[model samples]
Every structure is written in structure tokens, then in C-alpha cells.
Target: MAENLEPTPVDETSNRINTPFNRRNFLKYTGLTMAATAIVLTGCDDDDDDTTPMAEGSVNLGTGDVGILNYAYALEQLEAAFYTQVVANAAFSTAFPSALERSILTDIRNHEVAHREFFKAAIPAASRIPDLTPDFSAVNFSSRASVLATAKTFEDLGVAAYNGAGKLFTDTGNGLTYLTLAGKIVSVEARHAAEIRDLISNGDFAKGDSGIIAGRQIVDTNGLDVALMPLEVLQRAQPFIKQTIVATGLPTQ
Candidate 1:
């Protein structure tokens, strides 16, 4: 039944913009492939889940690894919604839309959708975060700077959250599989972060001047990066969620 939540249909032609594409450009921006067989299929029914609905109210994610995973899932839901809206309602210039810009947006949209779906599939029962209606009314879709800046914020925040939560994952209990998946997803998220950064300011690949200058360091190994724990990220997302989330699932603490 989880598959019932299919992504809203997209209007390709209307949203299309002519942008250039090159390996260097492609390397600069990396995101998940949007085209997938997102079909409704018979899966485990979560009808019996007792947790409150994500949109109606908040449910403490409980304490422990499960809680951390749930927290990450909630954030993913937020990012996905933002990108979905961006693709559905894109901005363009009077000149032929740049091929690079159009391709990047499309890829970003797809990546967000894939990440959202992955979380849903991983924890269908309790991972549905309330959908936040994006407040892009203030953003000029026609402006590349505005759009890419927003993208940078989301991507950077995502990487930080995952890094902070990685240590909390219980490798002993959940099996290494869970940790492996997290690493894979986080790597992809880091790629997104770097790409967004490049768009905002060329030659400004990594703000964090980590020793690993061989490549960009989107997320530095810091205790609490500003982008990592942004309360605004939560505030902008609160409109979609009605209740405060609590951490749950540890041995009665």
C-alpha cells in the first residue's frame, strides 16, 4: 500500500529548458536518476501502525538507532517536497533556457524523489513525514542564483545530519546491511552537496578547507556545522508537520 503514494505527475515540455551538457558539467553536478518504475505494488500493509500520522501530529521517533533513522527520514521527506515543487514549477529566462540549468534541475528533482522513496521503502510503517508546502513564492524561479542557493542549503544540511547520526547507528544489532546502506546514501548526498555548491559560485567547490584538498569537502568533520543543524530547516518545515517529534524506541529510558 505504500506504493500508493506515487509522485505527482510532471509536465516535461512545460518545465523543459534548453541547457548545455558536458562531462565537466555532469561531474560538477550529481543527483539520483528520476526515471524509475514507480509503480503501485502489493507490499506489507502498515494499516496497524499505531504511531500518529505525520501530517496530523508528531510521534517521538523513540530512542536508539531506529529513532536516528526516523529523524533522517523526516528530513528527506522535507527535501523531496522542495525539489518536487521546483521541478513542477521551474523558472526560465527570455533567452533559450540553458541546457545545463534544465538538466541539473531535472536531476535534482529525481534524486530527491529517489531518496524520499528509499526512506519510505526502508521504514514504511513510521517514516511518513507530513508533506510541507514549499514557500517558494518568495523565490524567483527565473533566477538561477535563488534556486541553486536553496539547493545548496538542503544538500549541505542533509550531509551533516547523516554524518552526525552515523555514529548512532547500532552495527551490532541491525546487521551491517543498515550501515552499508547509510554510507551509500550519504555518499550520494555528499555528491549533491558539492554540485549545488559549484552552481552557487564557480571555483568555490568546498567551503570547508579540509586537508583533503585533492577534492571538495562539502561537509567538514565538525561537531555541529551550521548547515548541519539549521533550525530554519526545521522551521520552514514545521508548517507541514502539526506536532513536535519525540525520540522513542530504546529500552524505556
Candidate 2:
């Protein structure tokens, strides 16, 4: 049986200074409630597709559109967990002394949590993947550079994952809904990637020769963002994830 992966509530009273842009404000300002309500109203009509059987210990991400949603859900779970830990760490204040930086990070945490919940509501319970455990041992949360670098990795990966997975949705009835939602969310992730890059270096947001975003290899010669297959994305993400995710039944072409 899979564990029900509920979003962990972020602690309001922490060592860091309180910010006005909390999760509630995020939902209200972004109209996330209405969006989620719409998903809930229309997300369950599609039936679950047949999934390939997985190894006994590994988790199967399901098949068809559900697999893609599960894949997104798994990634969101990781991002939300990472940001939650970043804001809650004992050295959070010392690592990021700038109030603006702290506020921005907090807002990102809120956005990620909302994204996680949105997928949870969008995918039917029977098709949703289990809560994944993250392995952040490689990350030195106390160090500013370490935290920012990890944030860059996550944000960039998220954008690329959505870009890569968008074409795989084949369900004519609900595919558009998922694709539109993905577009909206990926835009936010791209913003986060840009913000983190700028924070790392004043003008490193989208700098590259002839349009490619340098350093991360996430952009191409045509100025388009890199799109990776599910297996490839999972391979890059596996280090942060403890669970062995078997991404079967996802479209290859």
C-alpha cells in the first residue's frame, strides 16, 4: 500500500522573520482556490490506463496521462519538501541575511506547496503516486551557496520536466486541461529558476551566447528550453529521491 502523501504544513513561528506573503496570501492572490476547484470538478472523468508491472520494491508511476501527473506530483513533492526544509532550517536566517531573499524563498516554498496540492487534487486517488521520501544529505543547508545551487537545480529541472512531458499527454478530453495547468505552473518554475540564477549572480538569469542559457545546458541554439524524456529526468532527479520510481507506460514518442 502506498502512503498518502499529504503536504506538510509549514511552521509559521520559526527563527526567520514572518513575511506577509504567506501561503494563504499566495492562494488568495493567485486564485489557486478557483483553479483547484475547477480541477476537482472535471479531473476524474478519465479512466486509469493499464500500467506495466514493476519490480516488487519499486513504485510504478502508472500509465498514460495519470503517469505524467504522478510524475509531476512526485517532483512537486520533492520541491515542496526541499523548500520546506530550507525555510525551517536552524541556519535559515544566517544563511540568507537579506530580508528580500528570505521573503522570495518563502514565497517559492508557498508556490511549490500549492503546486503539490494542486496535483494531488487533480489526479484521482487511485492513480496518484505515493508520498516519496527525499534524500537531501548532499545538500549543505547551512551554506548559502549550497542552498542556492540546489534551488537552481530543482527549478530548472522542473521547467524542463514540464516542457518534456507536455507532448506526452494524449487524453483528448482532459489533456488540454493538464497541458494548460502545466504551462501555467512551468512559467512559475521558470520565473523561480531566473530568480535563483540572478541571486547567485547579478545578471546570470538568462545569459548565453546566441540564446542558450549558459552553464546548466537547459537551453538550446534555437533559444528553446531543453526537453528531457521521463527516464532521463528521473535519472537526474533520482539522487534527491529515495524511492525507486519506475516510469512505465509513459509515451516515448
Candidate 3:
């Protein structure tokens, strides 16, 4: 999630969770909504320029093993937040039409929360990223299309993220351990991706170009799945994060 508050809250500001999300705002606001009316007073600025300035606060994900752990942690936070919203919404039952469908999503939600918590416990307090704010303003929790589509994006991104991180943990002694855990978690993400894709369209699960979609594509032609550098993953995931996710120090691919 983006970390800065616009000079003033406007019509479309995004937000994160409520357990004092301050690395930015602690409790001044809730959810991913802009107190648009608050900014209305500033509307009368006479300046001819109309371009919006980029947000200011930035969150560094750190470097080395810690950075990669934080990276995975950040993503789990996003997925957990998104799925939590889905299951809590009154429209949840309507969105999934079948008990099996609902249960699957429920299971996925639990899995995400577990993953999020795992990272929180695995990483040291000083190293872990703050609980992120999610900006799913464009998502319609009640709509089946919207929910499944968004789920697809998150699961697929999670898989690719872990895939790319594998090579970074090459500290042979501990590398195997990290890769093992990541492998186990990503396999779950892959399953979730396929499930969501099939829900979206039975045959659409692996239909996209190479690694972009949930298929067997690899870091290369061996068909292992796409591997995104930390920065690349951050760019794609940024829109959903209300907090700014800085990936500058992570190892480059």
C-alpha cells in the first residue's frame, strides 16, 4: 500500500487496516476512502496547473533474507485483507453460488490469514513491514466476477513472487530451508489460482501468455512459472496497497 497521505484527503484516497496503520495515519481514518468533502475546500486553488503530485511517504522493505521475507509478508497481508473483506461482506453467499464454492473461498481466506501471521511471527518486529492498508475501492465484493477476478490476480502474483524469491535465498545452508517453505506455500497459491481461474472460466486457468497467468510456464522455457523481481511485483501490487511498498533494496534479478 502507498504510505503517504495526499496533502489533503481527496475523492479517491486508499487506506489500510485499523490496528494503528501509522507508518502513516494511526487512527485518523478507516478503510480505503477519501474524506472527499474535506478536500472540497481546497478545490478553489487558483493555480492553472492540475496535475496531481505523487504521494510522499515511502516504506522500505529492507534487504537480504529479511527483505524477501517482508516481501512475502506484504503480499500475504494484501491477500488476507482482500479475502477477509470478501468473507465478511453480506454479499459473500451471493458471490459464490454454491456451498462448495463458498467453502473453498473460506478455506483460502483462512490459509491467507495463516500465511500472514506466519510471516509476522517468522520475521523480527524491526524487520517486518507494517500491517498494510488495502485499496480495493474498485472491487465490488458482492459481484462474483469482481471477487473471482481479483482473487485470480492475487494468487497468481503470489506464486510468481515466491518463484522469483527462491534464487535470492541462495545461502546454501539456509537456502534449502527457505526454498522448501516457499515452495510449500506457493504450491497452495498455485492451487488457489487454478481454482479461482476455473471459477472465472472453466478452461481459462492456464490460458494467458507464459507466466502471467496460472500455468506451468517457468522462470524460463522449462515451464516453471514466471519469476518477478521484487520491484516488478511491487509495481503490479501497488494499486491495491494503500501503503507505499518500496522495493529498492531487494536483490535485483
How would you order the candidates by TM-score, starting with the best?
2, 3, 1
Candidate 1 lDDT over 1-253, as tens digits, reads 0121224543344321111123233323333221111211122124424335444445555444545555666777667666655655635432216667566766766556666655554555543333323344455555667777667767776776666566655545333344555676778777777777777667675676431222435544663333333233344445544356544442221
Deviation in Å, model 1, residue 184 alpha carbon: 0.7
Distance from true location, Cα of 4 in model 2, Å: 24
TM-score of each predicted structure versus truth? 0.63, 0.81, 0.74
Stronger candidate by TM-score (1 vs 3): 3
Candidate 2, position 90, lDDT: 86
**Sorted on lDDT, highest at the top, how do the candidates line up?**
2, 3, 1
lDDT of 3 by residue, 98-178 (tens): 877887787677667666655665665645667677889889988998998789888888988998898886444422356
Q: Candidate 1, which ten residues in sequence have the lowest lDDT sum?
A: 35-44
Q: How far in Å is the alpha carbon of 100 misplaced in model 1?
A: 1.4
Q: How would you encode candidate 2's per-residue C-alpha lDDT over 48-151 as one tens digit per residue?
A: 63332355546788887788888998898889888888887889999999988988888788778778767766777667776666778899999999999899
Using lDDT as the measure, the top candidate is: 2
Off by over 4 Å in 2: 1-26, 33-57, 174-176, 208-217
Instruction: Assess each prediction's global lDDT (C-alpha) against the native.
Output: 0.51, 0.74, 0.66
